[model samples]
Target: MMNIKNYKEVSSLWIEYKSGLKYYILKKIKNEDLADELSHEVLMKIYKSCCSGNEIKNIRSWMYQIAHNTVIDHLKKENKFADEVTEILGVDKNNTYEDVEEFVEPLIKLLPEKYSAPLILSDIKGINQIEVSKKMNLSLTATKSRIQRARKLLKEKIIECSNLEINAKGNPISIEIKADCEPLQKNSRKNN
Candidate 1:
């Protein structure tokens, strides 16, 4: 039921898609290594789905959906990897910046699909918010709201991280201070 000609055509199409996907994903991810890694994931999923005869009638739409999900999943996996890496690096989990940035990455994965694009485009790339809105075919207000929420979330994460560090230090100080008072009480007992 399969033709060699059709397979060859699909292979060529996949190659073309890969180049575009690399640049597109790279722009959004901000890290060369990460974009390359996620692009590889997107390509693999597309190739596998197409070969499996998944009835993808709209190739563009189907490919975009797959790429989007692949990127989100990649983000989640990267966050986990970062956390593990921080631990392996002997960074203190309770008062470390390592897990803070890494943990926030996965939260971006939770943003609405509609918001993800504009936020990544405008915030990550320093593109004008209005320009990103036009590119996404979204209203300027919606684009601004997404960016605002993203900033707010990051701010909260930083504050939470600072609080964690402070709390971790607080317990140790309280214990040390209590221990210091015990020595003073022992000296008073001797004087008595």
Candidate 2:
């Protein structure tokens, strides 16, 4: 439980950081009302986490990390919610890309850090190869090779998990993660 001083500190931090955090969220989400809502959600999440009695060293880093994940989750939910609405209204019939992404993200974690980090930075996070190389402290060529190897490994895992044969166009006939796959066991974090 937070003592009076700690509670005041948390409140002061929120007051100091709320506007900048809201602006960051607004820049990504591009909706004023939604950004405001998410900003409040961020503070609420931080408050809950703080009250839970976890020892937080470096509160700024902890808050920003939560902010980052919160934004990703909000964007994902926004997209998914839109898809759901469209599906219900019969506005779209194709779900192939979404389905593959749903499986691929989880599968990406099963890979070794060398393979996974590059792939995630370049492919998933949309960071450029050069930037990823710099970030990973690797030569550009090595980063490129790791990304390629990671994709190959991911493809093999996808095949083994989904039990599907790909067609000539390099598309899976069906993308489904098998329940008993190694990635599923390795990634124990339940999907929200």
State TM-scores per candidate. Answer: 0.36, 0.45
Q: Write the per-residue lDDT of candidate 2 for residues 71-188, one digit (tens) a residue.
A: 7677677675756533432311122344456667788887898899999999999999999999999999999999999999998877777644333555333343556786654543
Q: Write the per-residue lDDT of candidate 1 for residues 98-142, one digit (tens) a residue.
A: 333443444454456665667678766779988998888878898
Question: Which stretches of model 1 miss by more than 4 angstroms?
Answer: 1-7, 80-192
Model 1 reaches what TM-score against the true structure? Answer: 0.36
- Provide the overall lDDT of each model, using Cα atoms, as 2-decimal numbers: 0.54, 0.68
Tell me, by lDDT, which candidate is best: 2
Q: Give the CA lDDT, 0 to 100, for residue 83 in model 1.
A: 57
Candidate 2: list runs displaced more than 4 Å: 1-93, 165-168, 185-192
